[model samples]
Target chain A: MSHPTLQELRDQLGCLEETQRRFSRTIPIADAVDRWMPHGGLPVGCIHEVKGASVASALAFSSILSARIAGEQGNIVYIAPDRSLHPLGLLPYGVRLDRLLLVSARRSQDIAWATMEALRCSQVSAVMAILDSADLTSSRRLQLAAESSGATGFLLGPVTSAPIAAPITRWKVSSHVGKPGQRFDEPAWALDLLYCRGGRPGSWTIEWREQRLNTLFNQLATQTTREALAG
Target chain B: MARRFLSLFCPDVTDDRLTQLVEWCDRYSPLAAADGSDGIILDITGCIHLFGGEDKLFLDLQRRFHRMGIQSQGAIADTWGIAWALARYGEQSIVHGGNAASALALLPVEALRLPYEIVLELRRLGLSTISAVRKIPRSSLAARFGSTLLWRLDRIFQQAEEPLTPWRPAAPYRASRILAEPISTVSAVEYVLHDLLQEICKRLERNRLGSRHMDLACYRLDGTVDRCEIRTSKPTRSIPHLMRLFEGVLETLKSGFGFETFVLSVLDVEALHPTQLSLSQANPVEDESSFNALVDRFGMKLGFDQVNRIRVRESYLPEQAVEFRSAAVSPIAGAEWPAYRIRPVRLIHPPMSIKISILIPGGSPVRFFIGERQRRIVRLEGPERLTAEWWRDSNSRWGTRDYYRIEDDQGLRFWIFRDSSEHWFLHGHFA
Candidate 1:
């Protein structure tokens, strides 16, 4: 008898279809970046981290990501360290201020508890928590909670702090400079995928346009970027 | 049958002390009020059976007062007038129904709570006792004295009603539990609270009412009481939801020694219509309720103010553009935020002052040191001049602010402004 391949065994066990169904409910990040992820987008039911960005850049990126994952009518719970979120700035990122629940918790433990609570709630589609730092145990707990409820979690560290061991994907974001004479019509960021569970690392220069974060591939912008690889 | 009222008299207490004493007496009945500087009246009509009977209830009151170093007299009768009179003068403590006339027959006319001059005049007319006053015809008494005498007689005989203003408005929805063994542990308290919550929730459901605010009072073995309160964003009587709200609060309760009695009172209530679930399992109604429950949970853990929703305000100033409202409150349909304006994600309130070196007096900065690092502006936007709203506040001292959105060589953007005095301040950062 011939040995079955991994895909054939997975098909025979009926697990491949279930896995596809689970990963298929991805939160589409951007055009070029989604093609690089194994699941074609940021997978739901898991925690993702955004690091190496300034306070403003991290907030803008996470808010845009949260709005994309939440969709219309889905509630987004944001746990922040203070009452500093300007709702006006979020409008440009397609965030529905009406569907946003802001939880201001000062303590690290309180922030973790609130994030877990929001993740476990089926009513919430996305939970974005801005923390000073997060450890492995808390990150794992948050991941398990999101898995149980199928809600996407974004752990945003305003500054580039130490990385943790648990998030399925870790992203490093920095403000990307425009061409010397090119008009800076919109904000742009260089998103670096430093780690992925089942995919290779990649980089992209993305910008906000038409109420969504889209990949920027203009010759002038791509000059600063390294070679784009297909996964 | 007429309702019964209880009257207690403290000969030595003053007005302030009597007010406090009336509040303590609320445990006996819902309607407890301070009758005068020396007395308290309680409407214990159907509440007697709770303490076994009127005699037993009276004895309990006496025991409590004696323990508190007070010499008190108490009486129960068909009306507050009779109860008040009998508590002060009648030999019997409790008068049977329809026997108010016979009960006050031997008491002095002063027992009718008449004015001092009327009592003295009644004594002068040889009509000192209530029975002696009753001997005179009603017309004759009305002719002799004014209507005050007749009104007082009618009140004593249960012919007129007098309303008593209670010290605290008793909650219509309340449940209490008296533990056989005082509980000191948090788990035990939670168990008792769960039981009480079920009872109250049933009542709320039956009446189609939901409570927005609830107060839990734990009567400790000592004289003091420990209380904790929980409030929801919307009216709710869900036992599990309410129990979750109490989980964090129960731990903070000081069960010094132990708590013997627990009372949960619904402080605020609103009509909550029954919802009809759709045939399809996934509906927006369920999601809305669960979202509200999540907000309530966070509000209970943190303060309600800590859980907020941002609302846009109609103001020109950046700082006055938005306000944070507690999530527990229903959002008022406010003005929709206009298309995305050039605003920073994080606005540094009361813009921090920055040291700048400008080549031209009214021009943009050549270099500014944010902390110790010097930043050279690579790209500069504008000198968008915004004048102060002098019409809004005439006392305003500041004039115009020349704002600029500038990016440093590292591509870091800053929203800075130059005031009338040429001082530059960093207001916000573009994301």
Candidate 2:
């Protein structure tokens, strides 16, 4: 082959880096999420922001994600400042209450510190911090700690207009009232992928019943059709 | 290599003062106790050499007491009785191993520690000295004094045993240090604590033991003792882990005039067989690794109560259905909650009352207002009646309730109940 131009060589190097990132360790949460993510699932050793209109909605989603990240041998540490999280509700999500450590701290700084400490532990597979607010500095510190121990972290808080930190992914989940006639069905959530680094962002309506996530739409098929159309 | 005993006679001192002296004398020997009301007994069998000899140790103790404005006379002998008798009556402070009989013969009959009546009776019988009493037959002494005189004689002559109950139980594992210059800063205190932790951990390792509870006592120059204690979920002897637990406590320690002495005592220990260090730490449970350390850190930073593990109990009441236990004190076993009625993930404790307006009287609520905010219900699925647990409390105000799981128009699910008094309250959320 002819000698590659400088710009072409740079593009090839960038493509190699993207490929390497795609192979990073991840925890597959659902088929739709896995197919849409560049890494095939939620990336480990990084922070994911989960914001919602209600505290309970954000908490419900975080608890489900925490349970999945903390597999059979790992533990989940939840730093809850308000102490409002009910572990009984987590039973339906298949979270082992025994391996779940609940730390009730009143101050936001204390919550952040406890979250970082839990994230640094190799035995802890995930840490979820439910606090009022966090800054860029604390977020970066949590990111570094999680990366060092290969533990995933979730910051669950209320939706705010202010830009806080650039996490690996940002998701906004709100309650989805099913079609008017199907209002009595299982709990459904309107999940919006607001931001995803190196991956395409998409929205989907999913339902949680019998301890599994069921997508309301055929996201995989729709994604393929869109890719073909773009090509 | 016979055991040595030391006795000190403190004159004109109150009981509290004597107790303090007994505690202070722990520096000389571990087995130190208050003798009656006026004296202290110390089993300094193997501890005398630490101070360079029995004579120097005795003098040092007396000099320290004198400096503290207390009058004290001390003596060391082969037995506590001899030491007590000599320290109170005899001028000699140190008695050699042998010559027990000769030493006893020179003292008065009262040296036997007999009742006042018996001493007077011996004196009246012309037995003024121990030698004179010894000359009489032992059976006669027992018959005259009712075995009290013989017991005293046997104790002094080393024929009987008298164990000293220490001021405080001597911890099996202990390490202490007396700084030449008192330390006041946090760094200095931590440094001393570091040394003490190493020393205690070494002893624990030597005996294949691990400490479950540890206490650090800082004896200040102002004569006040400040102590901090830590309890672990599992027995451990790791120096770094133990040091981390003490880090928070050291900040709150008041080094009034500075801490002159530091003592680390392992109050509780259990058998901990040494395990071979593995090259790969694949097993977290067996390692007792970072997870426990994390618990300990959180326990220290926040109150131990703040770090909790939740467990479900056998109860119908939602709040009572789950219990939060401190992870520092109890081991968390795998939780297998029983299948029960559907429960909300977030429980609003002390449920808030709401105003509800229904289209049809006594029918399902169409809308409810919490404060000024209103929420419209789109679907309803309840009327599950729950009666008050009469056995729990006879005077409970909650007589009965009809619970309903209602989904608002916005898709938010709420568990609400109407009491017998016709009041609606929002209890939980199914978010």
Candidate 3:
């Protein structure tokens, strides 16, 4: 019949609040790529969009993100609806299939639903949802679910001509041709910062080499004019 | 003697899939139990010899489950706690007995399930591996690392006892057959079922026991499996009784293209004491086992959810009431009703908001607007006020709720509630 003590009340409140705080919040990634992301880390409870000109470029972008997030301990849930990805192809990029969970959803809507469910788990570090054809309502629902779960989602889709409102940072990727007469020429990649929160919107051309993307914008401009004149 | 164990960690399990995984693990070993959020502890113990040695047994398990399309990783060790630790943290398989100590030498001290902050502190002190921490003095380790860590480490190293609560008791009799050629026809299935029944009956007769329940599992060629189980009203080892129970179930098997193997296991067997037979009841005309088999077939054909049992809980709160669980898994044995507080049958998913006009000491509501219709309250029950758990951020803005079971003029009863200040909402209805 007596009122509960102050310490008892504090204990009850702590017990109720402990469930949400039980999740591990560390962003598992390699030290090198972790330095490039904002806050020196990928922001939790947000979405990152990867817009690519071709399927190959979209896959490459996803592989890079997957390798970065799935560095040592944490795992990546790749929800692929459009294409079947070979696990061996991603190994060289540092994504171990043992640590990577591939969920093949039949429909685009199911991918979003599964992604929402995957994000709720504290064990999953990041989710790569290949949104081949997602409408605005489903995309909004995904964004809300990602926010609630405190997990980051990478929305990978084709580059549409029409501009769409994205929830987080959007990067456009395109393949570039390499220089001639080079035995081990670098793989070219052009990245456009289409949309970013409080970040600069600029373009950067990079060549994939030695487990890192090297900037080749200044070097490519001079060679382009000579090739144009020769043609 | 060397003891072998298998620990499974499946982290991708959602809220709905956890029950299925638990049941699936029960098929492999009776000692299986849930570990944390996404792990299963299995006690292989003396059963490893059945599938050959430990390595071959692990491979056989992996291949069988892989064929079933469920991804899993397993580790074997000398102790239950160590097996649990290595399955989640170790890079390679930790072999049991001989190499357990060497295998555990390279693992991090956090594998002992110590607090995260303590592990961080250990890392900061450059004490990263289990071997490194083992070098410290026992007294110092006990003082600095806390008694819980020491106890867990001792349990893992086999210096302490750690027993497992098994999923089911060990069954005494079991029979299995591996087909040289996969059989697809119903007659072939019946032939195999008869062979299995004969084998089981011989074993039971030698032991002088009768089975209460039996399980039949058909491992198909295409990796899908079908299971048909039957429970008897009394202890039975009769071949005719068993064959009749499996009669109708054989027609429903798809064969999944065809079955490569079949296994039959009997459980809950009791010693059969001979008694004088009555003439009227000798070999009863119709057995209850056949009736149960028919219900099982119908339930499997219609869907598992078609058969259900009502489960009641002990609570004064109405919404904490009763729930219906599948008859196959519900813990309620023999459908005995327990004494519980009466509660309304109908409950809304999300309580609907309503506008109300108060008439008393400005307390209780006389009338309320529910959707487009207005209803007048005839009598009001006692108000039971409840508050939300404010510690949850999702419910931070939730106010206090006062509930009342009200009767309307149309003789419809509603469980309505008012908020901390006087706002009303229709929470549920009485059936």
Candidate 4:
């Protein structure tokens, strides 16, 4: 029997390549409710920044994003520079801390560098960079790295600083203080959104209701007015 | 002294479950080598003593193989080639070691190592038995069968040596314990480990050697065994150090029922000569031993996958500078440093697209509207152009990005870029 022709070999090679690509579908997130707006899940090839004051909210957001990605069997690298957050905080958020690679950085600069590196690995589904400070230049480099690695980046930092250009979505988070007239058990939140790209930065007052985050804009008016008077 | 050798063959083996079988055979003899495709060859030289002699060792080997869920045929002979042949063609357990000629008397002519066609010809000539083949004229046999068959036959009869190359070098010390009654308790298991540890330590002390790594195998009554392996920073023979290394392992040893026997083997041993050390050299500020112990404990408790070290790489590209490695393994040290440049403390995932109100051509935005609030741009700098990697994606939908650094009225600097297709997007900001 004669050997197979190069043309026939090429056809077989093409079939194999197509089969490989068919197997490359994105995995589903675990918490189905906490899906990303654009891609049903966080877009695989973009950087997402979560800006907040307290480490708790920032980590909560990280845990939520991590849980969704991990539920799909995707891996994440979480780089923290300032303080170590208790893994127990993530348990309530439905995150398996074991699935997360936690790296502690002594310097803010190191944290940024580490985050960029984590984003470079195509295997990593998402990267959460917890920074005490992030300037414009570092954010741009991180965004570029995220695009190259095909991983979603989440930047967590203070909201006091002017908006950095890095994150696709910028969330402004404040503490949800308990109501004075209401019972101590009342859940509270200070959450806002500056949808700079989509236009109109809407502010929302939210509280945890029955294990779910609920916006209570009406009740927050009183609190906002009181704070305004104090200012 | 009968020089007995056992060749155990287990055909129809699958890859998923071969490690346990290999480890099981390791307990019997350290000289076990994988043979043919699936068989394991054990040089039972001097190893039968622990089983109370040769015959008892053979019986025990059979029973253990059966208990471990493996079907095997074994043959013992003065020569490895004869044992191998008999195991495949003859009976379940073949014992032949009294004399070479008598041992080959009943075996088929094919056992003489002749090719299939030659063996068939010999059989047609009424030379079915090895004795009949031997009876043939030696010069005629050599001329017809060639030197290959004659040499193989001589090797099988122990006239020539057949060397066996083992998969791994034979470990210097091996200690095994078989509980009279299946021990289920953790304390009872620890009690047995002490004896094995002492034996291994004694062997090491006698050899004037130290082991950097060791493997502990707990052979359960159910035929399956749990393995705990440890590596040390320095070559050590101390029983206490070995015990300490196994502390976390011992805590998590779920008997699954109970283990009746245990085996401990020392690997990668090296000569460790004691030397006089100065006070500073002996007592360093950071003790690697304690640090390693702590890392090992945390790794074991939290699972080794959870521990990782952050590594930095030298790259002009900001995102290419750092990575993470498993904490157990050290990262490569001393890389050339990249040129120093300002990098963000934080980078957002999927860069947020911003709507710039200004119509500036190449320089920077004079003012940009972010959300409802409009911020006037003050100082404008940079039009650093970065092209997309087109080689990665041939379709090349995304074009080049012209990046700019602009400061707003509030002195808030931002990194904004315009894409190749001329669409503008706000990429990042400097605090």
Candidate 5:
């Protein structure tokens, strides 16, 4: 048999190559997303930890990410220590209640276990393992599970969490309300990527408007990225 | 061709131990039984060769029972009736093939396992042994005993095979470990658990079957038994994965007063097809098999009911739009959720009562109060009107709600609706 043509090969590899790119690269944060973190966006197929000053901010950040990553099918398995998540609160984040698989495990071990378990299912596109404390070994396992399953994983913890070099990307989300002229619009948030393994990290002011997330970038990319890095 | 049947008379074992003894005999054959009338019956027809024939096998059984502090009378004969008659009455005895009728003739009428009144009547009639009963006229015996006597004689004589309604095979897979000394330590318990699990898994692998539910019972020295059951979402034969799932559950078991024996049984099993591994599995499978282990782990760690998944319903109403079910059950297939203009991620059940002010008659909400926090609605959208099906529920009483999507100053969005009675309720929030 003759060797397959390059055109035929390209056609066969189009879907696989696109999925690989989609899962490995950064995603769009708000318009200001690029400036805060050197990494382009959240890394897919690995755990991206989002820590907030408190539980509320951390939870809000998780909701934003969960809704953003959910897309259309399957569930965002949310493993929390408590049933404090109000289904009504997730609507603004673009997460539908029907799309969420709520796993309320009380123990830290259970949370870690559940997070890893959720990552094993490829149908589960995203998982939020929100906890007060986390173990290093379990977190590493969670990372591997996500990578093997090719699903995005988020670890939401309090900002009090000491920086451990486990997550593919680390972020701190700041809650922002509608101001002055945008009083009629929905709430906004500011996300600052602390570090990314192989990409630029920057801070961005993002708003949820109409039906989609709009990035608010006001100036040139290089200048703001440099300024973000200096800070 | 004659068959060898081993009938064991467990005279010392009462209620629970009888069942245990029946399970203990499982190694000999799958068709072990204790009909609850008396002792365990085993049709070891062709299996005697496994332990070096009748003599060695019976010796081993006797030794094991003796070590366990149980007294048993066992007999092996060509027929089940002869075997049962000898084991229940005679000292542990074995009748060679073709000698079952002669052996059974010496046993008393009581050895037939007949009722007390029947034995009394038989003794009164001057017929007390199987040989004496055989001397009676067959029709007279049938007339007096209602055919049971003739039937019993026929069975005992090996002229006809006794109808054996064997009890259902005890849980196709079962394993038990008896400790020489009662063990209460966590490490000892874990070791025994692993050993028992391994034993059961081996049998499962041999049969190519997987079990979905397993029950572990710890029999304490105080004669108390504590049992814990774990269920899996998918039938599995994986010993390592099952061990992990049982780890959390085993910790909670009280080895109180020390456990002298442990029994692990597969309560439910199904044929688990072997999954062939492809040369290159480029993508992770998203089928029930992929999520089954995850669900099982969660259901075991957290309460099974605590983990619930949602399914979109085929309805237009908000409450009827979604359904919540226990995680143990598989999820509804397909992603074809009912289409809607916009569905809220979070819906407040029974809608929170809120104070609302409308700027114009039949207009959208301009202001609302949730608890003590006052939210000024900056922009409002819709009057998506829906009416309750009063015909479906007479209690609904023709209730109608006009829903509106509103944005507040906090950048939070709310889904509020006003009923026909003019009471506005906050039904959902845009998270």
Candidate 6:
């Protein structure tokens, strides 16, 4: 009957957000990985952070997530400070060059700002940001924007950076480049889900094939033998 | 049909004062052309009804000028030629449509807009007025004054006529407002633009029309113009969308010497019908109108050429498979993208030349160095031979290329190709 105060409106919005979370569609992972996710799979509207030991592994993980969301008919926005995510490099990971839009910002603050802007556009399915610095304030702003717009956001950062408490999920990926003199058929990745809201933390060694992660690459061909290589 | 044209002549007016005089005349009609350095002519054909009639309109205009402290002479005639002749030489007079020729005959030869030297020569020959020059035979007039004198006689006598080119083209839609005092602030410019847009959009709504291109003219107190233009791919009548396009444009402009008047003109328009909304689920941010606004905002900040849309091409060559096009265009319908097979996400243009050491003479590569990084190939997968038409003009660059997906010791994948000359080039990298 009367006009509601700002606090009461915020409380009402919280109730609406909780109800909306129940109806959100979950992205299904592989047979062994579903149980590890908070919603049995990744949530569509939440912020998911991925930290990698090296640039290669972190980029690979980001590409995998982008491909999954943008697969057949959606747009993916990548804002990077380092100008990575080469359209050529993502080809093997099943990401199309035409579907991805890349933005190269000179500063880390710009990358964070661009990520928030891209997320606010409902047409974009996912936003992958590579930033060296993101304080709690900017991260919270990005999170709020992503939630209201219903677009997923991923932060790809180094593993050694100090941890921030804004993202809902934190993941760390490490690359295993076989041995000094040998190379394997597939690149193996060690994915450690460091934290997830209302979910148990887990780790898995994943081998990217076709589109999703499946095998662990346990000596698929036993590194080329010297005599076999000679023949 | 008989139409009325008014010509105003302000003596000794030049530069800024002259332009300001012309700006003040825009109130009577939009088709007001500055006849010469000190004159303005208006096509008051259908506009006299607004201020009653020609007598009332001219009197009202004269009263306004008297109040503004600007002195000027005025005359009205059916043709611009006669009106121009009468306003300068004769007293304020209205020449009837059928009697314009006789009325203009007694005026001085300068009324024909002739060169001063030509008028002086005519006066020296005892022909002072236009009527005196008209008495001479046509051939002698041409022979003596080099044909221009004959042309001027014809114009004054209503024999041949010329059209007037207004300083600003008469647009189909235009709205303007004048302020009591000049404003030098940017916010004042926007406030005027917002009100003008509201007025123009109302008339567009009445006629079921939408404007695609518009221009904003700011008439400063110094009589100079600061103009900005906006264009949209689709015809739109929405005021907010148009205002959004002008935000960046307005920011870049300097208000410089406050403007006393603002005019918004619609340069191009098209018939637009109301759009029907779908009942099903829709994302608020990704609607059709918002998408256009987003593109317009991008064009505002960066540039229109920088925003691009991707389109699929049928060419089998990886480099030719997709093309980037201007964002204003719509993608070709039913043009399916070539299914992603083994294509790399990032392609190196012109194929970066590299040095490779293969394990065997005709076998896979063993080691390769691209740039400063050297990598040993641990696994190799191709020789996918692709050959082009030998008769093709561009095929002279390379006859054939064998593409291979090569992996190195660092778990990095590359799309490297070997040309007919047996040289390896890195074309793309795989994640």
Q: What tens digits encode model 6's per-residue C-alpha lDDT throughout A1-231?
A: 224795477557656658336326667655445655645777776677888775556766767776777668767777665433444445556566566665655666656656777777777777877767667887788778778777788887778876655788888877655444222224567667788765556666677655567635344222322222344
- Given candidate 2, what's the lDDT at residue A86? 78
In candidate 5, what are the lDDT values of residues A102-172, reduced to their tens digit?
Answer: 89877777776777778988778789877555558766777778878777888887677766457778887
TM-score of the A-chain for all models: 0.83, 0.82, 0.69, 0.66, 0.76, 0.78
Model 4 chain A poorest ten-residue lDDT run? A29-38
Which residue window of length 10 is worst by lDDT in model 2 chain B?
A: B280-289
TM-score of each: 0.84, 0.80, 0.41, 0.54, 0.68, 0.73
What's the lDDT of the predicted structure labeled candidate 5? 0.71
* Two-chain DockQ for each candidate model: 0.53, 0.51, 0.01, 0.04, 0.24, 0.20
Residue A14 in model 1: lDDT: 45
Error of 5 at B244 (Å): 5.0
Model 4 gets an lDDT of 0.62
Q: Note the Cα lDDT for every prediction shown.
A: 0.81, 0.80, 0.63, 0.62, 0.71, 0.70
Give lDDT tens digits, candidate 2, residues B251-368. Answer: 8898878887888889999888887766676653334248888988888788889999887776666766678888866664534555556667788878889999899988999999
Cα deviation in Å at residue B52, candidate 3? 1.8
- Report the CAPRI category for model 6: incorrect
Show the lowest summed lDDT stretch of 10 residues, model 4 chain B. Answer: B337-346
Interface C-alpha root-mean-square deviation of candidate 2: 2.2
User: Which residue pairs collide, candidate 6?
Assistant: A87-B345, A87-B346, A88-B345, A88-B346, A89-B431, A91-B345
Candidate 3 CAPRI classification by DockQ: incorrect
Q: Which residue pairs in model 3 clash with each other?
A: none
iRMS (Å) per candidate: 2.1, 2.2, 28.5, 15.3, 5.3, 4.8
Model 3 bad stretches (over 4 Å):
A1-231, B13-22, B25-28, B65-71, B91-94, B178-185, B219-225, B252-261, B274-431
Residue-level lDDT for B41 in candidate 5: 84
* Each prediction's RMSD to truth: 4.8, 5.4, 32.7, 21.4, 9.1, 8.6
Model 2 whole-model lDDT (C-alpha atoms) = 0.80
lDDT of 2 by residue, A1-231 (tens): 224795477557658766344337887766877777767888888888888867677777877888888877779998887667878877777678888899999987898789888888888988888856657887778778888888888888778634348678888888877654442324788887788876667777777877777777756546653773475
Cα lDDT tens digits for candidate 6, B6-113: 988877777677776676576678888787788888988888877688999889777766655677788999877778888888754787866776787788878878
